[model samples]
Target: MKDAWIPYATRAVPRYTSYPTAADFTPETGVAAAMAWSAATRADEAISAYLHIPFCDKLCWYCGCATSVPNGYRRVAEYVGLLLKEVSLRGRAMGPHGGIGHLHFGGGSPNILNPNDFLELMDALQRHFGLRTGAEIAVELDPRTMKPGQVPTFARAGVNRVSLGVQTLAEDVQHAINRIQPRDMVVALIEDLRGAGIDAVNMDLMYGLPYQTTQHVVEAARFAAEMGAARVSVFGYAHVPWFAKHQRAIDENALAGLHERFTQARVAAMTLEGAGYVAIGLDHYARADDTLAIAAREGRLHRNFQGYTDDPCETLIGMGATAISQFREGFSQNLKDRKAWGEAVTAGHLPAERGIALTPDDRLRARALETLMCRLEVDAAEICAEMDVPDDRLDGALDAARELERVGLCHVSGTVVTVPEEARIMLRTVAQCFDARSPAAAPQRHAKAV
Candidate 1:
């Protein structure tokens, strides 16, 4: 690790997945605002939708997502009913938008749903949302809990892409994080998924976990390569136990230090790039022929709640408890309380609890941030021209990048700023320069930059 980069690596920053980050959302803008945004969608436009399944059969101690083990399928079934209601409620609320072009099912392990319920949910999404033919439907999976027949059920339900959470193959490391699916378990699942024709498989891997090492990250990357995974997401485990209380279960002493974490991340990138996987901004790697790689090569990669993606829909509808919907006019998130969310949906109202409406300035900063995060470089003047604003609109951001330049995290030349390849792991720290809402969030509100 570069000694000069050490001090900056520990700085807390937003992931720039959405900016103004979810940190800036407020009660002042609630479901009413969400309805206004969704209600204005034009019929000619394509949109995306995300369904959040906030339940897992067993919780992974290192997980920072909003999820809990439901103890039994009864709770999950009830949630699915609520989700189905929400699907129709929000779908009918839209103004004949040109159907869902892309759909994502994220979780606490979307695979935890009973196969029948899963199919039933998909059917509702299709019936209410007019799911565009050939839409890219994706789901996040937890292999350990994946049922015997989910692959076929998912395929028949139009799931073309599936992401498996395969954090690590090291037994001791797995035990440390309290998620232990053996290597062969993942292999068998992959084979089953491919055999069922769901070949657009993505794998999620992580570094900086308890007892994790550089070689452990390499082993996982190599495993993804050997399995012909379409894309691999290598994340540096953000150990924010305060935010993710269950993370407190992780052994702090067993976690990798800043320098070691940096090394592990670098080695993982090296392994993936060497194995013919194209690095997709920040922590993702995609095969040369994968759509994500194609998007990156053509400068079309987009970052969203799911991280780097090729999905380019401007509006994304989010459903279920704690789900967040993104619109050009603003963003809204559903209530985190399942009971409250269900009650609201049952009452025929959008369950959005809080969110932020984007201002003109917010939109500009977000565009600038997305450009830098996706391309690793941004020209302030170029973005201003695209937004039809004065070139100086982002002058303050350029000045901020100059400070980061002094620290070796980024370079600011003229009106353009670029993160050096070696400093890419700290990309969020660089992107934070364009965030006007950073002052609204404390350091503890986000994870470490590295």
Candidate 2:
């Protein structure tokens, strides 16, 4: 049955993190738009914050992020200083928001920061944004490089959740990806984090890496379960060497075929489910008591640049180099180049380089795409009615959905488009039916639909 999903996996499609996707962002919509959106944020509206730390001790060959390995702690410390300055700049930009309900720290190993730096950064954020009473402070950690005092520092700073990047436990697999961390190291990190009162631990696992196999995938999944991970994200490695030059280090021949990749993913899913985890949207799974699982069950799941999330805030302010922020009106990105970002921030300017504003049509299509991506289905009439879109306006999308129906990717019964459970992995191709801009040209930038 898993092999049956092979043919459809060959099609390239966007992950649908956003309707138009990041490939469509242009320089014309820059810092001005971002500033306007930030200023317009209602005082009573809850906000989500994402802080990027773009430094790592070692560069993973398969990494597809805007990050680099710093030569020493001096560079990382320097970045933190700049980040503090940027936080103050952003705090002034937004001005007295109600409170921050969600704060996420992501990047090239956020755990690499010294304990003092991490706590200072948290204090700066808390002072500026006013952390809500029960806000969730989530940080992505690279367990391999976590310092001794980091966990306690996180707990002291009110960190509630920690996501560890444990891509795989096999020595050969880790070596191939140039991220060598053993299973014991990960277990120790989890234990330490748990001991420090951070009970919610999320582990990331990968299936489609070069030299990865079904056995390796299962092993990683079982290990995550054994370590009592509250949530697990299993992702297929998208080999886009052209986009991520470091990926070229991977041997093309060592990569699995589409069928094998599907099998590997299924094996991991089965292993996790057997260990009592409920599958969340797409590639995430959570324990029954986890907030993510509750979100999935209640149909309150959301798709963000970071993938599946339980955060319900309409606005997300992303700070630091290469961070992307989402506002009620649009999406904007900071400069990807570190030097340019630092220079712009130093000059008392937002470091935005590109962005896209949402038109009425864009917002409507975005709602529909997000619904499909989160729920694996969308009622075209229902959503259009809510958005007050005319029936004739969505004719092109209806036609596209009908065409997809013929391909067995979706079933359009009246106006409700549903992707069967078996075809859930290819749901992005189904949701792409609603995209109006360059749908034909989408393939050039998309990862695989499956």
What is the C-alpha local distance difference test score of each model?
0.90, 0.86
lDDT of 2: 0.86
lDDT (Cα, 0-100) at 364 in candidate 1? 92
Flag regions of model 1 displaced more than 4 Å.
439-441
What tens digits encode model 2's per-residue C-alpha lDDT throughout 242-280?
Answer: 888989999889998877877787888889999999987
Query: 312, model 1: CA deviation in Å?
Result: 1.4
lDDT of 2 at 286: 96
> Model 1 residue 169 lDDT?
97
**TM-score of candidate 1 on Cα atoms, chains taken together:** 0.98
Model 2 spans with C-alpha error above 4 angstroms? 1-8
Local accuracy of candidate 1 as per-residue lDDT tens digits, 307-334: 9988888899999998999998888999
